[model samples]
Target: MSKAVRAVALVLGALWTAPNTVIGLLGGVAGLACGAQVHWRPRDLALVFDRWPWGPGGAITFGNVILHTGDALDVVCSTYAQRAAPCADPDIVLADHERAHVFQYMALGPLFLPLYLLCGGVSVRNRFERAADRYAMTGRGWWPWP
Candidate 1:
């Protein structure tokens, strides 16, 4: 996609997921206050919004917390701390997986949140997550499976 198109998409995507992004920003600030370093990758904004809510194994059960159980994004808020550089081999695979979820949010728009909750379970097992996994593992050519 062209730069302009991509920019528009990002803006729209951010807007579509604003609630989650805001929560993420707040969580990110808290994480920073708690000594977690911030990381950002230019290729995709996911890393930019990513934040390790608390140290490993630490849980803070609040709004949308479940959405960030793993390397997740409830529209925003990632629960891991790492470099902001371009993803490498294995990391790229993982990033692809998460990227698929981004597309899911884009497609579902406002309905993504409720549907995700309704789906339940982790991404590996959830229906929506499985679709994302398939998209990542395969491609978008065969989406909205029958």
Candidate 2:
């Protein structure tokens, strides 16, 4: 897509997910006071905070904001991914998985959270998480299975 078109799409996506984004921003604000570092990735159209020191030792994405427990976004989330096997894809990264969530929240808006919980919360059995991993591994399939 052209830059202008992509920019407009990004604005609309961010707006669509604004409510959750606000919550994520609030968490980030709190994390900042606790020594979390934040950065904006223009390519992903997302904000990422690292060393947030919360959750299950990986990362969680709310809308386009990602809070990662680690100091970087490229590591395998073995402690929290809840998968049956270790990731074998050398090119796959945790940031890609979180970015898939950015799209999921953009698509589902506020309903995403409740539905995510209903779908099994943080388990790898969760379709949302499975889809995110799919995207991370294959660079496609971010939508939860029907």
Candidate 3:
């Protein structure tokens, strides 16, 4: 890859591990404020939990399997072994909503994470939830719970 590409990769990699630095911090905080917790798991999966009050909700990531918690987009599993169970007792009503957000990340690519953070810290959690719901409504046909 070219030097510019490499630099961008490095920057993104660092942001992935921890997004509370420099401009990336702004995004991270925004996401958190919006109730979008960023899970920097070791694997290449970005799980988005749609929890209210910052602790209860659904999550989504891409791997090799799909987890159904009554959501639209399913968490992609990483391997065939993971495909055994499609519905997990995740105990959340918005797994599918979060999954759609995960798709949003996919659409935004690297910029998604940072933007999520910023949104979290900037917007009120409820507003963030509504915004996410709006996105899901148009993109995934799911409405936010009242």
Candidate 4:
């Protein structure tokens, strides 16, 4: 597997307890390049989640997805990697996958999550995953997947 592929797999493995929406690794600097607007370290993510009453993860103002679990990636859910994962224009797989979520949010507008939960999320999530994979394959040398 490529670096991007491995990273994605590693991130997905860490994030999914229910297989709802796994957005992949949070590459800090890289994530910023990719449009992630937060300035967070791995420890900060852990602290927030560990200390928070609601749970480990929650959505940030700019659409960043913060997973509270240890080593959990902080992602920008708006742009690529939801503007969370670090990559100034990620590898093909990463960008494509992340962008798919962006598109979904665009299509659903404000009602994305609520509708997603009500719609048996598996289908939409699967569709987005497939979108990333497909987009990655066709993206040429855009993202090395590493």
> For this target, which candidate reaches the highest lDDT against the unseen true structure?
2
Give the winner by TM-score: 2
TM-score of 2: 0.87
Winner on TM-score (1 vs 2) = 2
**lDDT, candidate 3, at 130:** 45
- Candidate 1 root-mean-square deviation in Å: 8.7
Off by over 4 Å in 2: 78-82, 85-91
Name the candidate, 3 or 4, with the larger lDDT value. Answer: 3
lDDT tens digits, residue span 18-97, model 3: 32223333443455676544444322233322232332223323221122222233443222112234533232224444
Provide the overall lDDT of each model, using Cα atoms, as 2-decimal numbers.
Answer: 0.49, 0.84, 0.39, 0.36
Ranking by lDDT: 2, 1, 3, 4
Candidate 1 clashing pairs, residues 3+ apart or interchain: none
Which digits, one per residue and each the tens of the lDDT, describe model 4 over residues 41-111?
A: 34222112211223223321111233232232333223234343564443343333343343344334455
Please, what are the lDDT tens digits per residue for candidate 1 over residues 57-145? Answer: 32222122221323433232222221323433122244444656666665566677687787674533457655654555555621334
Model 4 residue 72 CA deviation in Å = 12
Candidate 3 Cα deviation (angstroms), residue 50: 14
